[model samples]
Target: MLASRNRDTNSLLKSEKKSLLRFLALYTSLVILLITLLSIFYYQSQEKLMFSNQRAELSKYAYIQTKRLKVLHYFFPERTTYPRDPRFKSAIYDIEYKKIFSLLENENIHFNEEIYRAGNYIHFVKLLDTYYLGTKYLIIEVPEDMAWKKEAWKQIAIGSVLAFILFMVFGLILARLFLKPMRDSIVLLDRFIKDTTHELNTPLSAILTNIEMMDTDVMAEKNKKKLNRINIAAKTVSQLYKDLTYLTLKQEQKDHKEEIELQGLIRDRIEYFTALANTKQLYFELDTENVIIHADKQKITRVIDNLLSNAIKYNKRGGTISIKLRIGSLEVSDTGVGIDEEKIPFIFDRYMRFNQSEGGFGVGLSIVKKILDEYHIKIEVYSTINKGTKMVLTW
Candidate 1:
């Protein structure tokens, strides 16, 4: 069932891809969230430090002006001139919150220690003693320039991009690390199957060849029956070996496609399994036309052999198998303990056996399906429990 194996491999790969994407997406989201929060914190801290330094500079200027005013009040008591600084706009207010003198036209200001931003200026307010030329509040306004904030944001953006790249690289590494064990186990299992199949080939061929060469005519009737039983058993093992070899070494097999007479091939395969069928007293009704098909002979033989083998193996004692071959189709119907409707869909799956009591690896239908797929053949199955199964293959 190369097709089935390929499908399984593709399905597994898709599942792994989804898992990798999910892990990467979740990890990227978390990293982005952490980076965003840290950037916000760094930006706030930088802004706070910048404002604090500006406020200190403004407070120094206010102190200088206050000292100058006290000196001017003692020297020229009647003059309206007050000490001023050219670095920033300044204002003086009375105890009733009324402005006395200001370089700015607007007098709206609050008496608080913290800095405030209004319009395009950084505002700072402080309380003054009435002894400093009767001024009760001093306010300072500095022009606000956001160049430092823009630079800080640019740095944060660059840092976030670098962090995302680093996390993606590490996430891929982590995903590979997590999948390593599973890959190793699959490789180990594949090696075991290949080795086991290789080992089984020689002994199986030897047994089947020797049994075929045996002289059953010279033996007593009872002994002949025993020999027949041995032949049947050997053939059963031989079929299993063939299925295993096909699954393991299918890629190595060479295809030689040629026109084949379907009638003769079906008859030959049926004869091959005659001994096995006789074990259960099964009979066959062949209604085959002399149809010709262009396909690999060995693969077509395998398809027919597996189907006949399953029909015989699952058939009741003295059950009749009806085989029909027409222009572009082949039908095999058997009086067997049939498969359930639900299980019919999975009948072609490797190692899927509905009847566990039957002695088989459950790969017969899977092999048949693969061979048919190569020829672009379609198969339909119909069955009723405790009744029979009818398999129809149409080109």
Candidate 2:
């Protein structure tokens, strides 16, 4: 059936979604890393500027203390009192970098550096021409000001947040742009398949109908064999056509739910594919019970048809196909080229084909999974390469 198909282009494919997430993660991480480096640089620059502004003021204080020390040196043994200031703490160190006398809370000082910071205090060293009270260095200590730090952190936090948001928005847009071509190509391919399958439907139906009506018993033996081959080919095409038709019309088809007897349905589908199985001389072993379930019959039929088709298509010549249907579960297994253990997880993905030697578009299992998922049925796969694969469906 040719139907007006509607699809949402905005939704991403599963592969595309994974790509987008990876890209965003790397992008966001890089953005955060860059912002962190810049924040560290900015904070250091601000701290250096603060230190520079206080350098001249601290130097002036040291000079005044030096002048008072000279006065005290002259008045030694008379007014022998050390100079003190409330604006800053002062420490005097000898030429050997040892403390002579210190008014500073933390007496530890570096003589090599002119100015540096220690715990909760900034120290400034001023070299003296004359040793006053046996002092060669006048060290000034002041409480480290942290007002600039608060401002720097505030700006950094705001900037980082803004930068992250902006980059994430750009990342999403770029990801969409990157996936656009793939999405477009898939859409075009889907449309082409739909159009080609639609044209083949009428001729395919006519061929099958005419073949059924032919009196093969009256034909020559060789002619009958050729007709049988043609019938097999036509049925294969018919099955493919059904699969494609179901996919193209899936959006428009409404569910016609009813009670379906599994035993009868399974027998009918097996009979339908008997000719194809005969081509390979494959034997079928059906162990079925009269299991009944409520669901859309057409959808359930597609599931069974796909399972049977795969078993036949991939089976070895003269191999055995075992089917077990019970009240709670069903298993379809074949002694064919079993799927690789690692590749089993992706078998249900759309257009997933493991064997290039086999002829198929690989939409069958995907369709099966879709229907089973809708009915809340669970399917398990037990497979071993070079042995066999068993598909177990449980409700």
* TM-score of model number 1: 0.56
Per-residue lDDT of model 2, residues 1-395, tens digit only: 12343432322266567667888888888888888898899989988998897798899999999999899988997997788999998988889888888889877778888888878889999999999888999999999888878998999899888988898888889888987887787677677778889899899999999999999879999999999999999999988898888877763478888999999999999999999999999999999999999999989999999999998888889999999999999999999889988889889876677588988888899889989999999999888776778999999
- Which residue pairs overlap in candidate 2's backbone? none
Model 1: residue 126 alpha-carbon error in angstroms: 43
User: What RMSD, rounded to one decimal, does every model reach?
Assistant: 9.6, 3.7
Per-residue CA lDDT of candidate 1, range 1-395, in tens? Answer: 77546634632463357567888889888888888898999899988987898889878877877777778778875766876667888887888877788885345575755577767677777677755766888887878778878889998989888988988898899987887676566545545656787888888888888887988879899998887788888888888878777766663467889999999999999998998898899999999899999989888888898888889988999999999999999999999999989999888876578689987767678778878988899999999988999999999
Model 1 lDDT vs. the true structure? 0.81
Off by over 4 Å in 2: 1-5, 8-18, 47-80, 92-99, 103-119, 123-139, 281-289, 315-320, 335-345, 382-384
Error of 2 at 38 (Å): 3.5
TM-score of every candidate: 0.56, 0.82
| lDDT for each candidate structure | 0.81, 0.87
Q: How far is candidate 2 from the true structure (C-alpha RMSD, Å)?
A: 3.7
Lowest summed lDDT across 10 adjacent residues in model 2 is found at: 1-10
